[model samples]
Target: MTYRPTVRGRRLARELRRLRELQRLTLQEVADRLDWSRATVSRLETGQTRPKPNDIADLLDLYGVPSPQRDALITLAREAGQRGWWTAYADVFTGSYVALEDEASLIRTWDTQLIHGLLQTEDYARAVITAGRMLPTTEDIERRIDARKARQALLNRERAPQIHLIFDECVLKRPIGGPGVMRAQLEWLLELAERPQITIQVLPFEAREHAGLDGRFTILSFPDPADPDIAYVEGTMGDVYLESAEAIASHGERFERIMKQAMSPEDSAPLIAEAARSSP
Candidate 1:
């Protein structure tokens, strides 16, 4: 099975690499010692494959990792290998993003196009996916919609992530499914804004040539500080997950600037309400 690692999975991979380097053992040397293929060791360190607890224990023993640390890492390996709900929609969630999103403690997104996916209503999602993807079959579209609904459930779960969304004002005016669907979506946004964990802001058209003009990006912050923040950018060609400290800092600053320019959640609520009332 292809591995789409969650935050814990990534942390385990980093620990594995660090331990091997600390022992001054090359991948080939470790593979030869364990009578395993070099590719297997490399894949384990790079998180290309799900780690088995037994394999992790073997590596820990070889590295002279003590009982407590070894036991901790082995536990992590087990957790990493356990499939998440996203596995059910493996075709739809072809990346680690959904897995990461499921565990994020804070989700900050800056978008110049449509509303954030978690905030989208069913009708709006259908229109957007149908138009944006040009999916050939109805089954394909519904599968994605189902996957999206499944993903949205994270917001309602106990200890839900604090979501801060800043989208371009044009999104409110875009009649995606139709006037009625768009209106309902806007009203839905107003209702969602009432929730304590969600904050919705709109960057008006007048804020031209702003920091967020570069395009949309999402920053996922995990509860565990060891995991580090990830800046994600989705594009037609592919998706990019930025983890370097410099990249995270850059995106963080840009998002702050965009937030500064955007209407406050209080002001944005009125704007969204007005948009819903107007003829689309």
Candidate 2:
């Protein structure tokens, strides 16, 4: 089984790599100094292997990380090795997005083709999975559906992330699972929009020159200021997670621009309700 690391794991890996670079130490140098294999050092630095707290402490001592910061990093290393709920659906998710999404305090998403996963109904999701040909067999599709439903539970969890979705107007009109399914999906969006923690917006077709023309993306922010925000872009090739300050800033500005072109939540909700009624 392939082991997928959690967001904390990735953060720990980045910090370790940064520390090595700061001290101008090569991977081989560190491995030789610590009497460990170069492969072991590489795996830990790349997040391919779970980090041990004791090993992390030893590294910290070598790097001269002091006081509370060192303690915090050790805590993070331990947390990084722990499994998250998404680990159960590893076959379905196959990426770090779910883990990061699970831990994010805020999720800002823009969907051009369909509704966001958090707002998709079961029937709607099934239709989408079928259309995308994401899974080879019915059983696999069903498991993925189950995984998606489980992901939606995050919206109801205590101190759930504040989810903001901006959908292209065409998404509301696309009938993915026949008329009934499409209607249900649109109605579901309306219901979710009523929640205080959720915000829904629609970018109408009239807005020909929109900022999201580049593609769909999600920006996740954590409650802890120490944890930097992430910008994620998904495509036919694969998924990309952008962590650089410049990348995050660019995505943030793009989202803000799209939001400006999108309808207000109040207006979007009514349009969603109308689309549901008119789906047939």
Candidate 3:
């Protein structure tokens, strides 16, 4: 199975890098000192490989980390290696986005072709999975649909993330799983818009230019100040996550401009309702 790093895995990776920097040690320097290969140290710092407790202890000793902090980091390494809910669907979620999203405190998304995954209805999700052609068999598609529905549980959790979704007006009109499915999807959007934590907007075709013309992207923010915001861009080939302060700020500005071009939640709700009625 492909490795999808959990939030704890990410946290551990970040901490390890910070510790190495604090000690003013290069990857090669650490590798030589520990009698390990540079690639091993690099992978651990990059979250491509999990760290062993003993290895972490050795690094902590070399980095001069205090006893209390060393113990905490060792415990964190163990937690980071544990699997998450998405592990069962590893074939589908080969990336770390779902794991990061699971722990996000806020999610801002912009889509031009389809509804954001978090807001998609069951029928719509099934249609999307089938259309993607990523899976070979019907059983795999069904498993993906079930996994997607399970992911929606995050919305109803006690401390749900603040979700802001902006999509192109065409998304509501482009029939996905036939008219019946499209109608249900639009109706579901209307219902979801009523939630206090969810905000929906539609960018009409009338807009000559928009910030989101570049394409779909999502920005996820965590509750912890130490966890930096992530800007995720997904494509047919693969996914890219931008974590630099500049990337996060740029995406943040882009989302604000897109929100300006899109209809407000009040206006969007009526448009969705009308589209639902027109679906056929």
Candidate 4:
């Protein structure tokens, strides 16, 4: 299958292009130094193709990068090549979005509807998937649920990424899969709140004006310094990945604005607890 390159893959490609330009190394020259085909180097730099670990090491050597920098570059390339676990559930998600989610070292998520994927309980996830009329089959739905569950593992990793999530009050009021499922989901969120690495906040309905009112979006920050930040905006049809510094900066400002308007974690926890209590 011809899967589209991920946001992280494209960002890695862009960085390679920038570095090559900085060194004034033509693609042919670099390829010659590495004894590789010019087309191979070009594809990798253009994000038309993914490169293996050995390929990354060879290219870094050809670029004459220092040891420390070379190691980081290689790591970025390796990450770009690894297939995301979501790929197994390719029937459920857009490929590019899955890749971006996997590469993110820090995720700032704001949602106005249901719970975000990383925070969703199994019942909640199943309910959401069932509600999507376009989904194909029961197996497909299970695959997606499994994929989401796997993604949650990132939160439990020894070096887990930092997640800061802000949810609109409407999300708490909307009951998916009836009250039992909703209660479990809210309880799950409450438990997640206790994690030192996670930060959860809720925006009250009375906060009539908020930056996230535009819709849900996520800002993904990478471990690789050379790779630029990405903003992902998903809608009914497709998703958009924002990579330019100006675009990233704009999203960052919006995130800050929403964070300022939303309730603090201390206040938000009680709100969630109250919602769980009210659930029938």
Better of 1 and 4 by lDDT: 1
Error of 3 at 261 (Å): 1.3
| Candidate 4 clash figure, as a count | 0
Candidate 1 residue pairs in backbone clash: none
Q: TM-score for each prediction? A: 0.98, 0.94, 0.95, 0.83
Summing lDDT over every window of 10 consecutive residues in candidate 1, give the lowest-scoring window. Answer: 271-280
TM-score of 1: 0.98
Global lDDT of each candidate: 0.93, 0.90, 0.91, 0.84
lDDT of 4 by residue, 1-280 (tens): 4455766678778878888898898999988888889999999987878767788787766667888878877887777777766666666565476666666789999998978888999999999988964567888788778888887888888888889999899999989999999999999999999998899999998789878878999998889786678888887787788878899999999999999999999999999999999998
Better of 1 and 4 by TM-score: 1
Model 3, residue pairs in steric clash: none
Residue 262 displacement in candidate 3 (angstroms): 1.0
Q: Poorest 10 consecutive residues of model 3 by lDDT?
A: 1-10
Tens-place lDDT digits, model 2, residues 1-280:
5556677888899899999999999999999999999999899998888789999999999999998999999999999988888888888887789988999999999989988888899999999988886667899889989999899889999899999999899997788999999998888778888889999999999889889998899999988786799999988789999989999999999999999999999888888888888977
Query: Which runs of model 1 end up more than 4 angstroms from their true locations?
Result: none
Worst 10 residues of 2 by lDDT: 1-10
Better of 2 and 3 by lDDT: 3
Candidate 3 residue lDDT tens string, 1-39: 666777778888888999999888899999999999999
